[model samples]
Target: MTDPRQLAFAHRRSADQDRLQPAHHPVVIVGAGPVGLAAALGFAARGQASTVIDRKASLSDGNRAICWSKRTLEIMDRLGAAEALLDKGVTWRTGKVFLDDRLIYTFDLLPEAGHRMPAFVNLQQFLFEHYAIEAAKRTGLVDLRWQEDVTGIEPTTDGALLSITTPVGSYRILADWVIAADGARSTLRRLMGLGFEGRVFADQFLICDIHIKMDRPVERWFWFDPPFNRGRSALLHRQAGDVWRLDFQVGSEADRDAEVKPENVAKRVRAMLGEDIDFTFEWISLYRFQSRRLKRFRHGRVLFAGDAAHQMSPFGARGGNSGVQDADNLVWKLDLVLRDQAPERLLDSYDAERIPAADENLLNTTRSTDFIAPKSMASRILRDGVLALAASEPFARRLVNSGRLSVAATYDGSPLNTPDGFTAGDCPTTRPGAAALDAPLSDGWLLAALDRGFTSAWFCAEGISADALARMEAASARTTLPVKPLIVSDATACTRYGAASTPACFLFRPDGYIAARWRSIPPDAIAAALARATGR
Candidate 1:
């Protein structure tokens, strides 16, 4: 059997390469990684086409980002890539924290039920990219060009001109919009003379992927000071294909080359899993955590997503998950802009919303790093004391920070979000700018019912009134934007949205985020909210 990671995509010359004049594309994406492919699929779902260019001819080489959050899975499901991921990925919802040899506390990521996706799935980055690529190909809208390097970029007032170089020759293409998902050392960002503004920690970590069969449950296990590597933090997670990801914090002074040696790594593994256990090395690497992001995600017609826009410590599994969400947030807005359905200024909201999300991730990851690897003796003492107390004390458990974990970012103060018309005391989770919570409906899941456009969810226990139905019909007719009406009669969903008694309505953006809500369906409120949401 051939190794899946070794599979390479064949590069073929595109017709654009032979065009006498520069061919213009509506959207051109640099990098065919997860984010870029996702952007392609997202635009395709919106009936838009995009040309994706990547220097690489294959998927990711190693088991790079292995943790996929539920929010990410939800977004992937919309893009038509979640089924394969869920089938092969290890589903995990619990994590254990330890202090030396003693287990401090174990936490459940998802305490509630009724969600279609699990809390997190552990799958290799290569597999994630492969599934996305397969989905994009199925759409027949993404023009993926492999081994095509974006050598130069000239920013125009309305778009960009990208100079492409391949093995055969070079060609120039005009893109009405450019998406740069090239990654941390982004060539496009450098060409534009942009740089990230944030902190890079001093500590280094050694990551080793080992293939072994064990009876251990699929869960995240983190240790503060284990016997395997005394005075350092360690993390272990089970991935698909009988592989386990192990992360060991090797202080800044440790020699990178020495730590990566198979013998040295094996010694640490033996210490952790006992000398009798057997394992084979699949991949080994050394990395330093950085909580940094570009000052702005949008640079005129050129937009950045994923590592090109932001980077964070891998502790919380926020990097890839946040990157996919960036695509989800951006593609719909861009699609509307392309179709002339919304003002160009609507794209600016991407910056307003995602920048704050990036900041939140940076803040949380920085805190996690600080707690895991204390910079000073004072901080170390405090962390140790907290860890010691966490075993029995609930208060100390709250203070423990193995990693805060990834969650969807809510656009709390976004200009697109309308002020809440009514108090949602019972369900604060469905507030304006919040991601719509998923719940089981009579027929299917709530998210599946939302289905690819703006949605007006009317929650009425007593059933929608004739006047409210007419108001909703009037609102839909008033706007050119697609706003599908969803009548929520499910008791569980009604309670989840805090509309069990009185009638309530919520205007959800195309990205499944609440734009506004009301106690009653106002005659002109949905139209006005749609106008604001699209930057009219």
Candidate 2:
């Protein structure tokens, strides 16, 4: 087993370098979790600097979150941490669901190939934070301070006044914008008198990680009413370093403290694995969560991201993945606002986009929870009926809800999306407000071509006239924000993007979401759509 102390990342205390004093920062972030660190790195990617503070002196030792979705991996790729994460993560795409001793059905995520990242990778949250912190430090723009805590915050005419406590002494810092990423029990959200509204499930779960050499394949295995745990559900996953994560649903009547005891936990584990096998414990914990989110994510100059803004049960791996998307959505708008490129009203779109995303997560989690642990006898009977039919009937398999895996939510009615005027033959996969699809290019994947700004993919036919090419180039230049232009001529590339018609243009936002697309490249239409997208 690995020693937790040896795994701690080295972070120097800031108060020792200089005395605490009143200071001003363009942006300040509270908490140093994955979401917070991702936000700091997101700012640095856009040539913006931010100060980040955390209450702890070292990184978390526990393997809190282990599943990283493909969408989240793409975000990390842009922040310069995807390679390190991929090197240390166990990639998996298949999942098997079982009912008692019988196998029900299996599913595959991302069945097609040619994407840069996999469907999901299992890596500890601490490793994710470590790589993100390194990328942020390398940017030379982020000021990451550990062992510092925020005591209070008050909004002012120009910004927010923050009272902080450090190892040496207490001081105040002023920031034009503040990001509250302090987790579920956020101090800033509490201090602001904001409350999360949702129902708290009465069920409890026990999570344990162990070091063992097993012959099981690298795929997610979930059991409903298995022989080892006859009345409850169980889940198994493989992580890096030969470690395995096992979770068991202990009913509400079970004592939380007693369930986590080594003797009791060992008894249950021994029943699952053969008594002849040996294993060593790494970490264990008990948890109960609520599916909830704040009514408003923004309060004056302060904004909330990650757990601070919303939370849900971890059944579907939505918690960390959605939080990373939150950072991706907020950073670009915040950077533009700070640089006077967009009006302050642009920040409202952050709320408009992410709150709906949170609602979708909450909805899926609630459905998964109900299916896994049925509330009433009628619900249990219905669940068992579906499970029985799933073994033989293909139609019944669709009803199997073993956690609807997280897929990036599309902002269909977002104010930033410019409606497509051409309805005929418009591609739904690459429609406005949808996440851009990743495809293989001659050199690399399509997503690699995009930078930290708006980009236009102008697809031209094989023998386009010089006059039409000039018109397309001219239209790309007239956009409000500087947009990088890519001229795609390959038929495969055109077919993949659904740009079959000649002289088509697709505008992608900085975060890799399609802002708008046109079948024909009309300069006036492109300019107007670009203005609406950039909040002009």
Candidate 3:
């Protein structure tokens, strides 16, 4: 059997190459990696079309980002790619932390059991891109042009003009909006003369992907000062296809070439997995840690997402997961703007919300890096002491940070969110500016029922009253923006939203975040909240 990672996508010539004039598109996405692809699919979900361009003719190689968070999976589920990923990825929730050879503590990311998606899934980046590509194709709204390099960019009064190069020749294209999803070394960022502002750690880490026949439980295991690599930290994760990813904290002084050498990597693997265990090398690479991001995500007609906007240490699995969420947050706003349903100022909210999100990820990843690879003796001592006490002390265990895994970011003070109307009994998890919490309904999941649109979730114990239902129907009929009305009588879902006793109606944005909630459906309040949510 051939390795799926080695498969290359064919690059066919596009009609744009033969255009007499610059072809115009409503949206153009640079770099068809996971972020760009997801953005295209997101726009498509809102009845918008996009053109995606990538310099590479093939999907990413190697096992790049392997951990997909539940929030990310939910977003992908909305984009129609989650089922394939869930089928092929390893689902895990429990993680064990170790101090040397002794187990310190165990943690479960998702302790509750009502959600549809798992806590985390381990799948290769290539496979993720593959599934997203298929989803994009199914929408028929994405025009993917591989091996097309963006060479120049000119911001216009209404849009931007892009100079692209292909094997045949160069051509120009115009887009009302351009999304820069090109990786950390972004050509678009350079052309715009923008630079990232943050810290770059001196420590380096070595990643080794090995295939072996072993029966290890699907769980995250992190070690501090283990026997295999004394004085250094290590992480172990199980991936699909019997592949295991091992990350060892090799010091800054280690030679990049020497560390990745098969013999040297094998030596480290043998020490960790016992010399008797047989394994074959799949991939090996070394990376330096950095927690940096662009000062802003939006620049007039151009917007940045993924590595192009921010970068952080990989320990937390925040980089890829957060990038996908960036697409989720952006597309709905962009779609509304394109359709003239919202003011242009709504785009500013994307910067307002996502910048803080990037900062949060950077802060947490930086702290994780500092704890995992302490720079000074005092810091190392503090980390070690905390690890030692974590075995028995519950409070001390809270101090342990082995890449504080990725979680959905809450836009606590976003301008788009309306203040909660309920005096009490509102669910904290589904409060204004927070992502909608997934819960089990009588027929399907809450999120699936919400779908990809503005929703008015009416939670009541004995079903919606005729008066309330008639009011909600009238409100929906009056609004230009379609709001799908969902009547939830499920006990679990009603309790989750704090609508068991007091009937509540929660207005959700297209991105699945709470916009506003009311004790009863009021036509005027719904109109005002919708106006505020869309920046009218």
Candidate 1 runs further than 4 Å off: 424-426, 464-467
Residue-wise C-alpha lDDT for candidate 2, range 1-536, written one tens digit per residue:
45433654445655433535568888999988989988998999888999998888677767889999999999899888799889989999999999897889898998987788999999888778877887888999999888788999998867898988877677788899999999988999888889888988888888988888999999999999899999789999999888899999998788988999988988878888878878988778888758889999988799999999998999999999999999999999999999998888888988889999999999999999999888899999999898989989999999998888888889878899998654855668778888887877767778888768888777664644666668777887887778776766656567767765655688889999988887777788777877887787
TM-score of each: 0.98, 0.95, 0.98
Candidate 2 scores a C-alpha RMSD against the true structure in Å of 2.1
lDDT of 3 at 429: 74
Where does candidate 1 clash, by residue pair?
none
**What's the true lDDT of residue 519 in model 1?**
89
- Sort the predicted structures by lDDT, highest score first: 1, 3, 2
Question: Model 1: what TM-score?
Answer: 0.98
Score candidate 3 by lDDT: 0.90
Whole-model alpha-carbon lDDT for candidate 1: 0.90
